[model samples]
Target: MDKKLIGAIMAFSLAGSLLFSGCSSKNQNTGEQTAEESMIQDVESEVTLGEYKGLPVTVEKLPDVTDDEVTDAVMAAVENASVTGEITDRAVASGDTVNVDYTGYMDGEEIPESSVEDYNILIGSGVFFNGAESSLIGVMPGETANISVTYPEGYPQEDLVGKNAVYQVTVNYIVSEEQAELTDEFVSQISDCQTVDEYRQMVREALETSRENEREQNRRNAVWDKVLENAQVVAYNSGEVQEIVDQYTSYDQSAARDFEMSLEDYVQTYQGVTMDEYTAAIEDIAKQEIKERLVIDAIAQAENINGDNATDEEIQKCSQQQGYDAVDAYKQDRGSDGMAEDVKGLRVVDFVVDSAQITEE
Candidate 1:
């Protein structure tokens, strides 16, 4: 599955933001019903669930972490913990990060906009103009050289595009990285473990735990996929679908605001789609999400695990699982209805998974 589609599915699966409209009160005179109850009732009325229990699913068997993988993981941790220091003994070389002061000139006239002082650039990184950083290679600190660079076509500055410019660059000290030795001292500094062997065992155990978690997640996904495949939606509730679409749109609008771009521009730039295309895609995703929610609700209703009647103890347990200090805080963040619906959906998933006949491949 596409990562973006997976993210969208995960976002919708939470049930926190999903709200349905156009549902009648269960009690006409009292007219007091939670939104979650109305939503579940609306979904149950709209969707017809297929066989969910005892569904057959096949998932890949978990693989054991190999010695080579453990070694690689240890090396990666050490590499990430490397410390950088100045290398004044060597001249600038390829892949070296060096500091420099430079002024650019076009047609023998200085370009004020291109001049920079004490700028740090990685050699061959192309941070400076074409061939500018490359020219610094073999130049020692305190040395000055005139390097010519040609700006490529379609450069941000149209006037400088395809034009040659001379830069009088003075080389500064190069930055070098030092990797920590794998010894008891280093191990004690990095972790509670005081020996290299102990650190290796710790890393191996962590990797095994991570792999096991991945395998479990894959199994759960397989079960959910089978359940979704077996389910059927009789008809989509337009009000609910529109509500989900609105939520999706609002999320995109917020993302656009974060990027400081207009919605149309953001969609076009990041999604590579016109507003119409994006809207259509969002609608399709919303409909699929609604179908999934409807199926989950249908299962919850059939199994007598409806969220509307969730006990206070259940809510408190859920709040603790969500890492909230108190139920009140959790309820304030996720509305009471949303919290209950999330708990209900989780319970339904657990039930379906337990009932599933799973085979490891």
Candidate 2:
């Protein structure tokens, strides 16, 4: 998960619902396999109404895929499905940390909650806010933040314009993220692919595909913005607050070259003069990610669109598929599977196809 990719996805997710992220935002799984089972049992009654018998069905609001907006997205992906980055900047190492500062404000207010200073953070640690740390990784210590943007219109504060909120950030630390010395464990990360290039390509495609899907979601959400203006979207946050804290640490590692430094060295390397400065920044980003995730989950549930399903069997397969002794380690955080999240994304895609009057751009 490249930070750029994650940042792009998060931004896309926030912008979408109708246009940026297709449905929901990024993912965070922790004890979800176990938690979903319990959640499922608590409300078994709801599903009794009847399964759609089609088993693994694809529902569409449109009559045909040929002339529908869905195809527009598919065709766009097919046309642009290729890797094209020059790696303009290469880091001395993936696990390097320097110094950094950020001026975060809510809307137009110089609110401290929105601002953090001299924040020191580990490169691969899930300490900074959404996409921020990841994006900052490859950058030089004196460089600006990789992912900077203004708060969106629909964001919490009415005062803040959803324009780009820029920051002067630095890469306080750098470590070699070069793939593990092609060891059994390292090879195992991409066991799903045949070769290293394949592995990288697969990862690249996964990222591109995610962005493409989010775009479709955004378009669909836009249609819904007009259609479901008054729809009672759920506004509750379920799931532990710390769940984010623990879950991202691992994901952050996955995004960068699995940071080479220990958490302590990683933290101290960042130029942020104070611990509060560094931590507060990460806290804000993480919270935004949470909000984006829940929003998508809620929207997905309202519509019947389904994305990837994490059934007990799928979990087991993922475990064996990756040659891991236990699949649980990979997805120890998510809950009840992302049923709500999948449904939201699916429905939004379907809605856009069903409603939007698309003309090729």
Candidate 3:
């Protein structure tokens, strides 16, 4: 409240105001933006509406976006898909987990006929195969399961028709994949690898090899698929599927043949009955196979899996795997008809592969 001081403060305030008014208005970083200038440029050109394709599309539903979220989602969905799973005849497991062996039989039947190991992952994943995986679940390795499953219709075992068997499963141990670590010591321990790069190279090569193997197996599967595809697959009725299983596995003949007797003779000897009476025992099995095939086929359609209809390149690769020429394999698998059926199956599975929305665990 000193008069001189107050006058001095007023003069200073006025001078500062004038200085600010005369100062340059441009931003320092770009050397072009005025304080009053808009941060936005002509942004009207970037927006798209309605026609976008992607999950969680549109900025309204998406997080962390002012706009253009739909386009980003579309691109993200398209970029990840790689699965080359095998369908094998066996699997190994035991303990808390099913230490499945490719070798499995009804509980007490002795030596395993299937030479493959750890071939199937179906049951463990909740899909039952002969009820093997399902019965195996909820049991420890040291535990035993009198696993009884009806032979799949068209099952090669005629005697096994609704015939229950016991398995004294001595689940030895459950195997698990030990997660890999990128450490120098680990590299040294696993190989004669001197450097980390060498170990990485080894891993890359192993992955490539696995991919190639899967590709080859997929190709072989394509052959079977092709046949089924063009076979005039009937509507979802299981009878049509049974027809297919009969053709492929020829299980009925196999069963009778195993006993070194005609089916007629075996039927009479086993039950003192005619083949007609025995046929009833195995009829459902054949039916089941047909039904199973139908279910698979249905899944193929629903999932759009078309591996049976493979490409020229895919065929060529598969042929090379069997050490036979691609054309020769096609001829052997699809005489007179070319590879039409084979192609249909391949295409369906390919579509499945193509359409799957995958995620990493």
Candidate 4:
């Protein structure tokens, strides 16, 4: 099995719990087939769960989905459903989209990169230099003015850092974003609803669904953490640690390439750490991940929680029903044996969640 696949599955398994991310932010998995969905599918081989009872688990403050949240999401979606409209008389303002032609000069030399023709920009969008958008305030259409601003010292472009530049800017017209009305026509654009009320209901239900998912994930994490606390290991191996480290390094390098940055620079800029520090962080994460894998595997074996134990023909039918093109295709993409093992882990999680003594606060 691919080590990256194992890591990806681990991430998927714990994404909703937000245990591995170590950040206060939430992880929203939006994909055609989320990692959790793929792994939760039925297995073709027999599997088992281990002893997972009487674990003392505590979950605090279950998630709540409110009407205000739904309304906010709907309003934001409406704002994004834009229509082009001309600003007749008013000067440019924040949130207003406007077209302009501009040329910049620094130290008596024209900055070619700072020049744009018939460019459309959103004021206060931070797409331009600091103070550039604010300087455009009160500038009427078809008017020309010279605006000056200084680039910050730590600007990514070393040549432009701490330098003052003057721009000769002209406002063509504002292509203002006119929000769509809460009408049947507008609602149909974003959903299968025929009315505003139905659309709002759908939005509310979606928020509730998300909240429910979060609540369930929190409960499961609490149970798993309890099991870990009392877990006893007679023996273990560090053989998979190297594979995990290699996978982590490769993932970081790929992200650095996507950002068009060197690995060291990417670490410093995004992770706020040196390359060595980032490596040590990932190594620590790998250790924790491997430990969890071993514990889950041991539990799976002890409980005998076989998921499906279906024949090849049955597996093919199950795969097709789960939206796979074919059994062979699913196996090729997500190694059949690996997926089966993951399913067993999920079964153990289910059993633990069901049997644990939970307290909600």
Candidate 5:
């Protein structure tokens, strides 16, 4: 299934936001409060959509779940698929597993904390720099060998970058891997199924359900795209766009914190974009998102579709289920009106999907 369409549907249909961690300020002027409050309180009445109806859309054909696909899916769930082989006397070779004691040295001095006993390394795994794994090839058990290699420039460790290092390596033992066979016992261990045939059937049914879901999402995506293409935006509020921009900014700052770098450094180093460039790009994304919301709102109004019918009791129960002690706290974090907006958008999308003329290929 296409992740973009799945993400779009989830974003519009859900009430929570990953980017925006803060809620809009409460409006004081509007004494006559309405049920449908736009996300941005100040710009609630500033942006409006003109019309949305009878949009042309074509849905693609649903993907088929082949026998090979079902087999692959079932095999992926098999427990203890690989087993270590009996100890072998064969020389260290590619694909062979070995245990060894190693000590690394740099500039003729043993590096502190660079020695390990009974360490495991898979031959030809490319887990180390040049010649580290290849140097162990053809070495017999209990044999000691020396491997010398230079760390490449721009290595993750600042001090070790471009440094020549030597390792005193010893081969402990070699072992091969044996794959587990497919049997009733294996099926019972991995899944609820008791037999291989039963497991295969279960995989087929699961694949069918997944395919149907993807087809439904594709239909919704087609409907939404066509609706957006035909919809007209009579006016747009800059404040609304800025609200979304703030979300992007907050998310970026959070990500930068995770990377142990300032937002500016993170953007320049990882993204190759300056803060100004990122802000401009984020503004465009925010505007596009706002436009989609406006279109969904217009369609909801046109079709007389409303999903914000949850009672106060229902809201309280939902809040409790979400681990909030009080409904007010839940409303504050998720926005009191966000649920209504999500419900309305979902209803509008449902109408679009139900009414769309799907042309399958």
Candidate 6:
């Protein structure tokens, strides 16, 4: 897959253990470990762990949330609760949001994909081709106009690149939008607060709690970074890396099928990369990910917190944290092996963080 897809899969896989399933343990039904599990076990045995315990790391002290931050957050909440209403009294202008019906034509031939009705567009927003939306400025509702546009170079559709096209556009109406005013009544409507003062306090407290969580995460990251720096992979497993690449390829094919598009077109449209470029990078991405997993597995094994030993409560909590309704649901989507790996990886990281010698900056 392309960089975007590769980054997404790698992030989700490495973030906790939502992707990839392999452990040294055997399946209850088969009584034999799968190829992936065997490969992971081999890689883990080959890894040379660094001095993870009491690793020295520095962390920044948490800062107090200021009143200005609280006010800004409250304003953001109010902005999110803004309203949009239709207006037909005035002519469309720059920066006005207009609903339009349009059809694009190139050399008297209609561009089928470019025809849309009741499409909401912001003037000068670049959502439409160059000057297409801007041309609607000064046009009153119910009026129709023809605007000429030249498709820019490097357009997604090769046939449309640098081609001159005419858009027949009809303005339906302008959308008038405004942010809600911060008042006692508005605060009560958007939140449980009875007044602005209560809302502000709530926002401040939320900000403080968010910052503390962020500080704790930073400390953990610092500790892990030091541990990884000290560790080394003595032998690289090509089989393990290829397994991950195959999994990524399968996911890419499934995604293409879901979008009802060819794999080449899907990669181009969603990932902004040619199929060849995407294929070239998959191996490297898989290698990096497999390396990280092997290190995590080795650490977990050394700490006696392997996936086979994860508790049911730990699994449930991990599933809930990852947005699953329950442990069974998580296992249904991402097998029991994947769930165990997630719990085991998290326990290892927490153990390393707890054992670190951290100094506040």
Report the lDDT tens digits of candidate 5 across residue range 66-158: 999998887776544765554646788888778889988998899888798987788888886754877899999889999998887776677
In model 6, state the lDDT of residue 193. 96
- From the highest TM-score down, the ranking of the candidates is 1, 6, 4, 5, 2, 3
lDDT per residue for candidate 4 within 30-128, as digits (tens), equals 425332223322222112233468777778876588788988988988877866677758888777778999998988889868788989878888767
For TM-score, the strongest prediction is 1
Error in Å for residue 104 of model 6:
36
- Candidate 1: where is the Cα deviation over 4 Å? 1-45, 83-177, 258-260, 306-332
RMSD of 2: 23.1
Q: Which tens-of-lDDT digit does each residue in 1-361 have in candidate 6? A: 2233344553442222222221111112233533333443334335678898988899898778998999999999988887667888899999998999999998999997998898899999986875578989999999998999988877898888888989999999999887789999889988899999999999999999999977876787777666655766565576676777777777777888999989789777877767776664565455445555766888887778766767777777566545565667676765767777777777877788888889987
Better of 2 and 6 by lDDT: 6
Spell out the clash pairs found in candidate 4: 47-306, 48-304, 48-305, 49-303, 49-304, 49-305, 50-299, 50-303
Candidate 1's displacement at residue 22, Å, is 28
Query: Please, what are the lDDT tens digits per residue for candidate 1 over residues 289-351?
Result: 676678778888788976677778767755654556777877777786777776787677778
Clashing pairs in 5: none
TM-score of each: 0.58, 0.27, 0.26, 0.56, 0.55, 0.56
- Stretches of candidate 6 off by over 4 Å are 1-7, 10-45, 60-62, 82-179, 256-280, 307-313, 320-328
- Which candidate gets the maximum lDDT versus the true structure? 6
State, as a TM-score between 0 and 1, how close model 6 is to the true structure.
0.56
lDDT tens digits by residue: candidate 3, 70-125: 33432232233222322222334332234444434665555356334443343346
Worst 10 residues of 5 by lDDT: 18-27
Error (Å) of candidate 1 at residue 291 is 1.8
Give the range where candidate 2 is weakest over 10 consecutive residues by summed lDDT: 43-52
